[model samples]
Target: MDLSRPRGSLWREFFLVASLLACGIRQASGQIFITQILGIKGYSTILAVDNVPEDVQEYSWYRGANDSAGNMIISYKLPSTQQPGPMYTGRERVNREGDLVIRPTALNDTGNYTVRVVASNETHRATGWLEVVELGSNPSLSVNATSLVENMDSVAANCHTNATNITWYVNYGPISGSDRMRISPDGKTLVILRIRRSERTLQCAIESFPDIFQRSEVISLTVSYGPDYVLLRSNPYAFNGIMKAEIGSQVEMECVAYSLPALKYHWIHNGSLLNISDATMNLSSLAWEQMGSYRCIVENPVTQLTFYEDIRIQAPRILSVVHREFSILEPTVVLLIVWIVAAGVYLCGVLIHALINRYSNRTNRAT
Candidate 1:
């Protein structure tokens, strides 16, 4: 080999390597940077690289570690389709902007994500962290009993969940500790002391993290207390203790008791129990015999409290007169005939006495 030729070739090779190294440094300075992402379970998320070069020839995605040490999730070549790994086979795709799109992500998909981009003269690498979490299934709320008697029975609302942090809510707000409302240490159970007749709503919740939480369905709580404030009302009207109705008229009476879980109704008339079981009693036709004192007895089964209200059924005066019309007519007719017969006998006795006296005097003169 000529000595000059060897020298020139060596110088050219050295320059080429230096130029390539400079080009690599420039590429590294302009490499893409991926941002950290948080993904929710069963929901899709994206891992995107910023400032990707237009001349990239090949793209590779890795999970859990760096490009050389991590498991390959997918790879894409210029002018060709992408190839995905078994775990993300159909669930992942590379968009036109070279961003990774995961459809319907799972909890297992969370890990360190790395992407390598091979350009014409340089290689670029970026890494990011992905955290996956779940709000989880809606928690379940249960109670020892749905209904409790006031001051005599208590109830516990239990929230069931697998989460680490649990919370309790009453009527859409956070529950505060009180003499009547007691919360357990784990916040899974809430106890109601001296439950009253007021209705309440309870709910449970769990937080996967701050600002991310799931809540359970609402539960209705009922406390049965009293049969107080009992009222008996009639359709037409009731004044004092009486409810008036005409014969052949329809009448409706209702018994109302302010109590939880409702009160059982027992209607009584003239110390006899009625056959109806509802809170309302309907009479199709009013009769004179049906007019009497009507009583409504309302009782609470939970508290064993009882209430009584009475209303007197008064028939119209016209109805009473019409009911005895035939009996009055028959007695009046008999009394009138007896008076006429007595008057005629008195007149006949007076006339006969006068005639006998006159005949005795005439007989004495003739002798």
Candidate 2:
């Protein structure tokens, strides 16, 4: 330890010691002061404190409040014993390196963040701000009935909001072919050609821009009178089942016939054609002898269809009491004449009694 060495040597050694002490103090100060940094809310980011001293104890972070009126209200606290505001809470190890990192940043993570460093002798702080944003949600779509009709040419329609475009398809059945129908350029309607009544079933589809195949609705149609022939047979030429009536009983029998074309009706009884001057042939009153098999013949010239109904009447049931009462009228006349003669005799007796009384009163007066 040559205390008295050359002056230059002493000076150079002293300067080197002083420089080393200063560097040590500077490092200590840097470690005491912690810094924090933040970025947008949705972005992944980091917290930086590059000027940390060599002996940093830890860090404290502060989350901002959600209120609009408040200015970065504290939400959490770190180093519970310190009990800073509830929001001023974050903890991490900060060493001389002064480098810090946070991964997988969240939207809530956006706010004012601070770093608190504690060295053996002092404490320091640094802060940074962060921003956040949210992405838009997926859109929705809807459609009318899923199918379409050709000859009716009615189309399936769709509705949606915030949509860019749409498309349609024929999904099922023999109408699976798409080329038969054409969609309008504006995606409004579909046109089909040479559509027969049988080809009424069709399927339609729709979509929106940016969305793949969203959903679908259906439609149905009926076509009128196609060439496909329908052969209608006559209603089996049914008779009115054979109606039976008693003579003298008023009978009204209707013979009805039906065909695509109109029909002419003729009435016949007992093998003789009934001259029907009117639609209803009136016999005025029917007699027992006139009872026989009655028929109505219906013929349609256009349809070449013929029909008939048969009706029969049984002979009248005559009462014997009515016949006996009619036969007694002659005897009733004879009894009536006898009662008249008895009344004339009683009238002559009354006249004789009156004349005798008158004669007796006159003779008594004269004597």
Candidate 3:
């Protein structure tokens, strides 16, 4: 192709090919210079020279200085196709605009490049640098929202970097295409339609050749759920879901639920709301009327969820009441039993002394 003309021009008005007129040529009349290019690693990029004469006959691209024959990459004469020079590599091709295109550029490609343009009267040369970047730093991860309601809200995540190979993971497991997820073509942006509690952690990584793996910082999302798993109990004693306490004793009853953002607790007794409105219910000087079924309501305000649970707060009933009464009288009854036993031992001692005296007197009188 005639590389001297503009990109849209089809006519072979001029040509710049490899294998330059192996001679030292000064910078021609025009202020022509190679346009500097920043190329991405593992991607296609181009290098071109600007302000060239329209009547050019040939073009040559060189690796570095055009001082020797071995430095020429490619050159072409008028009416001739591009031919490789001694330094030509198979990875480059010149476009119609005399721009050198490199496919799959690399880090070693970051260096100076020179282009020589030929016209009917003179030859011109220009030099510029190409910088191919392979990012060594960690990628950045971002999310649209950090907090969401489970199964009702969504989140969008983005990984920002110039990396070509992007992989995403949720909770340390690789993620693939799914109905609730969306991934951009460049693997930069991701969206989840519905957020769940199980997917709290997310990450993106650049996977390159030769064991080059760079991971982004973790993106954490909070999924709100629950108000279930309700439990009701007291500190001293609770058996079979029933809170046990004694009369005239102060007791505490606690209600709890498993939920995010905490839960609001409400106590209930006799099918009516009690004044106690926290996770704890305190009762003192309990009587028979105070012993009955007690209930509590748990709610998650964020999730708009409510859970109900009931427990019996029985002080003592039937045999349990008898046992309680016996425990109260135990010390007094033990003291009375001790006094009676002591009195009985003293009476037995007196009776033995009297019998011994009577027997001795009878023996003496007989003697």
Give RMSD to native, each candidate: 19.2, 28.7, 17.4
Candidate 3 has which clashing residue pairs, if any? Answer: 16-58, 16-59, 17-75, 17-76, 18-74, 18-75, 18-76, 19-75
Ranked candidates, highest lDDT first: 1, 3, 2
Clashes of each: 0, 25, 8
> Over the stretch 1-367, how does candidate 1's per-residue lDDT look in tens digits?
0111122355334433453454342334666855435666766666666677889888888886588633778888877779876445577777655667777778888887889888898998887767777655788999898767788888899889877587788768887678889988777889988876664778888876434567889988776778768888897799997888887899899998788767888989999998878999988998777888999999888788888999998876653434444445877888988888888887888889989989999999999
* Tens-digit lDDT string for candidate 2 (1-367): 1111122354435533453454342434434322233233333343444465565455444443222222322222223233334432242222223333333445675665555555678866554454434333333323343233324434443333233344444434423225656555555455555444455444443442122233334444443332222221111122344434454555555554434334566878899987762234444456776676767676645434466656665553666654344455878889988888888888889989999999999999999
Local distance difference test, each candidate:
0.76, 0.45, 0.75
Candidate 1, residue 163: Cα displacement in angstroms equals 6.8
Between candidates 1 and 3, the TM-score winner: 1
Question: Positional deviation of 135 in candidate 2, in angstroms?
Answer: 48
For candidate 1, the C-alpha RMSD (Å) to the true structure equals 19.2
**By TM-score, highest first, what's the ranking?**
1, 3, 2
